[model samples]
Target: HPLFPLLALLFEKCELATQSSECPSTESFNLDIQAFVQHQDRERKPFFTEDHEVNDLMIKAIQVLRIHMLELEKVQELCKDFCNRYITCLKGKMQSENLLRSDYGGYDSDDSSSGAGSAAGLPGIPPPGMPGGRHSVPPGLIGGPPVPPYYGHPGPGPHHLS
Candidate 1:
């Protein structure tokens, strides 16, 4: 009995690296992929395995694949939603700018009253006291001058009638 114990101890040198261990981080991802493949191969050997074992393995594989597909779908949906929101916001800004420009002095090419552009009805950026620029009639009133501070100021009121 003492010799048998001594013989077992001599042959029992354990290895730190074995099939059972915590998976490494993504930096060592190739090792994990190889392990997954090896695990699959080993689990499939012993051809006469019970039907229940085969069923269990198949179910596990299906679950992994399903999870991956669901994650990909979520990413796609997020991207689509972001794109739609971005486009809508851009259109709103552009429409507001067009309304502001059409009101300020750049109107249709049919008015034959003033050629100086400013002489027609374009507002000279009226003083701060006037909100609507021309007696509260509102800018771009078909004959009123264009509103002033055209560059950065938010026009009084909504500016967009549409």
Candidate 2:
């Protein structure tokens, strides 16, 4: 609604700049923004809000766009806000979905194997290099070879004192 006009204007300005070789003048930018608002009003179309999550996201987006248009006068803050908020929402949705699936997927809570496993399955832990999928040290003198007893000054065995 109110914010779409601003966002559409910004988009149109961006579009015009990309279409033309020369940098878009301020007048043209402003004109495009006006045209965008006019176009939306003429179409009488509502903002995209089929899903509740999408609707909420769009509201947040509009707020960010409003900041860019009115307060900060730049899109960097809007972009940052969009990315952070959207990612957090997505992560929240994913966690919620996982919880729902775990609750409904008939997971056997009594089974010990569900939680019993080596952390090697986790990400970033390099898989075992040797067989049986377990870590093994390279072949070396790990537990071999006893040092011979040293006689006096590297001479042979001790001789009888005559």
Candidate 3:
């Protein structure tokens, strides 16, 4: 009976709370509460309309969630596109290898002696003087005389390897 004003005030406050994009100012809060309370009958009014407040919040929240969900879906689609492109590129490279192998009289790709260092048949630039092992033992594999280990101690004996 006497609580009508109180219920209206609460309803007003909640309604105002939903209107502002940010927190309601103290004035706004008071005004809202007052507005809701005004709607209550003079003698008595039921609790502030829970249905209205809930409906408003639910709608706003759903909109925000939908926007976010769409953004995530877009990102997912882009990622899928990227993955597809990468797989296509890989497949193309593999196809190129297959075509090359077919042309090479069924040579297995592991036939390193036939082409591994040949960069798919492009002219290889020889490094300066020694000119790509055309002279003397290859850099890392100098097999001539047994040179002293002057470089430094050969570290502790190898562990566990046969």
Candidate 4:
């Protein structure tokens, strides 16, 4: 569990940020990263395996974290960004697994639906006015309308856009 410390730090920071509705400074995060790096160097063991898909997702997550650290340096926002990215990653992973299962004729309807629901529900989206606060938009959607589930889709119901 070489990554345990880093993951714990991320969860703790994200919880605090969500609870307080404020981003914390990046000082502690930086320190934790440095510590993690030093530990990895000392251990001199391979951290990543040959699982390319999982490896790619991990790389993407790290890149997203690094970008936020450099640009925002706000723990709260960083956590939000990271969490959103993470949800995307989970969705991708689930989709891939479903594809594999389908190919093998082992697809499980229960698993796929539950996986999708879990990923979707994890964010517990904030309301519109809470943008950049508890209800902040994902970074890519900043300055844009709040992205409701049906944002771009036309519907047949009363909620349909004109």
- Give the best candidate by lDDT: 4
TM-score of each: 0.32, 0.24, 0.36, 0.35
Per-prediction backbone clash count: 5, 0, 9, 1
Q: What is the C-alpha lDDT of each candidate?
A: 0.46, 0.52, 0.49, 0.58
Error of 1 at 143 (Å): 48
Off-target runs (Cα >4 Å) in candidate 1 are 1-58, 106-162
> Which scores greater on lDDT, model 1 or model 3?
3
Q: Candidate 1, clashing residue pairs?
A: 121-145, 122-146, 123-145, 123-146, 125-148
Q: What is candidate 1's lDDT per residue for 106-155, written digit by digit as tens?
A: 54332334232232345343332355334445455556555665679766
Q: What would the per-residue lDDT of candidate 2 be over residues 98-140, giving only the tens digit for each residue?
A: 7855654423232233333223233233335434334554332
Span of ten consecutive residues with least summed lDDT in model 2? 106-115
Candidate 3 yields a Cα-based lDDT of 0.49
Q: What are the candidates' C-alpha RMSDs?
A: 17.1, 21.2, 16.0, 23.7
> Over the stretch 1-162, how does candidate 4's per-residue lDDT look in tens digits?
445456667656655645675655667667777877888889895657677777676656655665554444455566889999999999999998877666644532233332332222323433233533443434324464454455676424346444
Against the true structure, candidate 1 reaches a TM-score of: 0.32
Cα lDDT of candidate 2 equals: 0.52
Q: Which stretches of candidate 2 lie over 4 Å from their true place?
A: 1-37, 69-162
Lowest summed lDDT window (length 10), candidate 3 = 114-123
- Model 4 scores worst on lDDT over the 10 consecutive residues at 113-122
Better of 1 and 2 by TM-score: 1
